[model samples]
Target chain A: MSDFVQSLRLWFAPGRIKDEGETPDYRFSLANERTFLAWIRTALALVGGGFAVDQFLPDLRWGVRVGLALALLAAGVLCALRAVNHWVRCERAMRRGEDLPVSRFPAVLSLAVAVVALAMVVVVVFGWAGR
Target chain B: MTEVRDPGLQPERTRLAWRRTTLSCTVVAVLAVKVAVHDDITAAGLTGLALSALVWVAFLAVAHRRIRALDAARPHPLSYRGALLAAVCTIALAVCGAAMIW
Candidate 1:
């Protein structure tokens, strides 16, 4: 347990990864950096969307309003965490001449966003009809 | 063979990505501020807004440093710490946004 904790701390500590692997092509690193930034931006947009729903939709049913806002905010938080961890993983892979890490996060994130959009549509359509 | 520097403008593209992300972060901060002030300003609201502003500035500084670093002939890889810091600030800002809503 101590070993795992130490490794986790070292993984997160600043400047430790620089010495581990040979420097790969700068272009690949830059690309990875850009991808990380893109994910961060996506997270920010989701958070902003959450705040917008809560602030702009005063007439929204309280339960639905909080639900949608919390969903979006939660997604944003997960994306933000995923963004950094993936960035570190890719950078490490490139340094070690290994294959870039891959995962199903993009698909999962898409599904999450779609579900939120669908929920919004249902709430809007039904709420309008009820009014 | 004298390899060309920046053969595909990758550094420029990366720099622009940083800029765009920074702008989006700024937008989020603005939105948070609006929400914070939308209702009567309480001490907690003010504190949340202040923390969000601080996080935005920290992220901005990190992005700006990386942007400048990309101008080199071969931009150094982003440090692990820098990337983590950027991500943490972003998450903190999102938490602030959530708190404002509640």
Candidate 2:
């Protein structure tokens, strides 16, 4: 438990990663940085989508509008957290000469997005049919 | 130690990615500001707008620094503090965006 706490405490230290292992290839590190930036962009997109749905869909039922927006916002929060965590893990693995850590987060994020898209479709279809 | 080669233009790609993400962050901040202004500005709305602006500026600084860092012959690994700050800023912007929505 203490070890975990210590590592967690060190996680945000400026030079924690450098102290672990030899600096890996600079190209690989740059690639990791790009991946992190891409994830940040994804998070931004989700947040923007949430705001658009809320502002533009004035005719949407209040409950449905807030529900959809909240879903997107929640996803954005998760994606942002995952972005930083994954970046650190990948960098540490590369420095240690180990295989890059693999995760199911991409699959999970895709599934969440698909589910949200389906919900939007349903809302649009039902609203249109009623008109 | 052998000097690293840069035939793949990795640093350039990374720098571009930072710029793109910064642009996206700016868009999100702008939208939040629009929302705050379009509606009657409540205290909460004003607070959220201010925070969104602050977070956006912080993120821009971090992104700008990283972009410049990429120009080095061999850029250092991203510091833990920098990545954490960037992530915090992005998440905070999302919260501000949500605040603007409802």
Candidate 3:
């Protein structure tokens, strides 16, 4: 019906549609959306990780239990922050017609994660050894 | 209106990665609670609830901000402060995860 068509147009109305006469910056928008979705997925994964630790390590003491909780919480917060940061940089690039800013957070965070994980491995191994 | 150059489609990929990370964190938190319950179920329950609440709030806030940025005609790049905060959080979480395993 005409009403349905009108409603659809209103709901899905392309606010920033590129005109044929205009050079569309499709790549930028596409990239931005993709990044947004990626962050969301990461956040979900972190939460899942927390649950996994809690369930499997029932014998863990306060130190382990609390540590796991904190780590997951940190991951969730970090992921969310990164997503926002990515969006801002991408948008700025679009506006200025320049390259997007590079991110160093990933590398730094990765290193931190690796180190912590390593420590955990050590602790678990030693604890088991004693047992 | 001036034509803006869209940054490379990197944000999308980054976003997806973050989502996975968060999901994993959530799982860990739940498991931590389960263990807590056995030792002191009430305390464990409280800790789990607290952690969940904190994470959920943080996630929701970030998601909301990202959506708003997308809608805006001119999106701002992620701030250095925001990035720093994220980095610190990540390191903290990694440490915590390690502690649990150890």
Candidate 4:
């Protein structure tokens, strides 16, 4: 275990004798990890927002409830998948010394989330007007 | 002594990020439970717990991967476990959130 710690320290710390080819890959990997974390944060926020809806408004209808639930779930799942996919692609690119692939999942998921939110609005409007 | 080749992975930062994410998700799950108390606190709590468990598993997996990858120095530069876990949590949260609204 001590040897493991020493080796890890040697790898991450600057000024260590290392292969020239590996440096760029390391930098990119770190960046990718950071980005992945950011996406996880985003997913957390989305899920939190879903809970917020439930907390703040307790009189919503069945439709609104279903829509919000679906939306939140979709957002979380998509964001998570996208983050991991992005990291894998980035890693692959780094390994091959090529450009990272463009990400479209975020945009698509965002659209879906927005649509669900809009449905919630519609449910509220219709239900309130009827009431 | 033969020079140990660096796989060039950032185990520390990666581990830290996983920890942070797990904590954040757990917090969110707890909040969801809190908000859901009046309507169906039990369901809310259950959902939150489930999400928390998922985050815990993901954290452990990432930590294990980080340790193994760094030790082997195998240049195994691929990570998708975190994102997949996030996806599952998202769906769970959404379902719980929608339940609150109902």
Looking at candidate 4 chain B, the ten consecutive residues that score lowest on lDDT are B73-82
**Higher-scoring candidate on TM-score, 1 or 3:** 1
Candidates sorted by lDDT, descending order? 1, 2, 4, 3
What digit string (tens of lDDT, one per residue) describes model 2 on residues A1-131? 67345546556574777788898887888889889889989999998888778878889999999889988988999999988878887888887898987889999999999999999999999999998
TM-score of chain A of each: 0.89, 0.91, 0.71, 0.70
Tell me candidate 2's interface RMSD.
Answer: 1.3
TM-score of each: 0.91, 0.91, 0.50, 0.60
Give one digit per residue, the lDDT tens place, for model 1 in B1-102: 255567798988988999999999999898888888887989988998899899989989999888888877788888877888888888888888888777
TM-score comparison, 3 vs 4, better candidate: 4
Instruction: Find the candidate with the highest DockQ and give its number.
Output: 1
- Regarding lDDT, does 2 or 3 come out ahead? 2
lDDT of 4 by residue, B59-84 (tens): 55655565466444333433344345
Off by over 4 Å in 3: A1-24, B1-102
Ranking by DockQ: 1, 2, 4, 3
- Sorted on TM-score, highest at the top, how do the candidates line up? 1, 2, 4, 3
Model 2 steric clash pairs: none
Compute the lDDT of residue A72 as modeled in candidate 3. 64
What's the residue-level lDDT of A127 in candidate 3?
69
Residue A124 of model 2: what lDDT?
94
lDDT of 2: 0.83
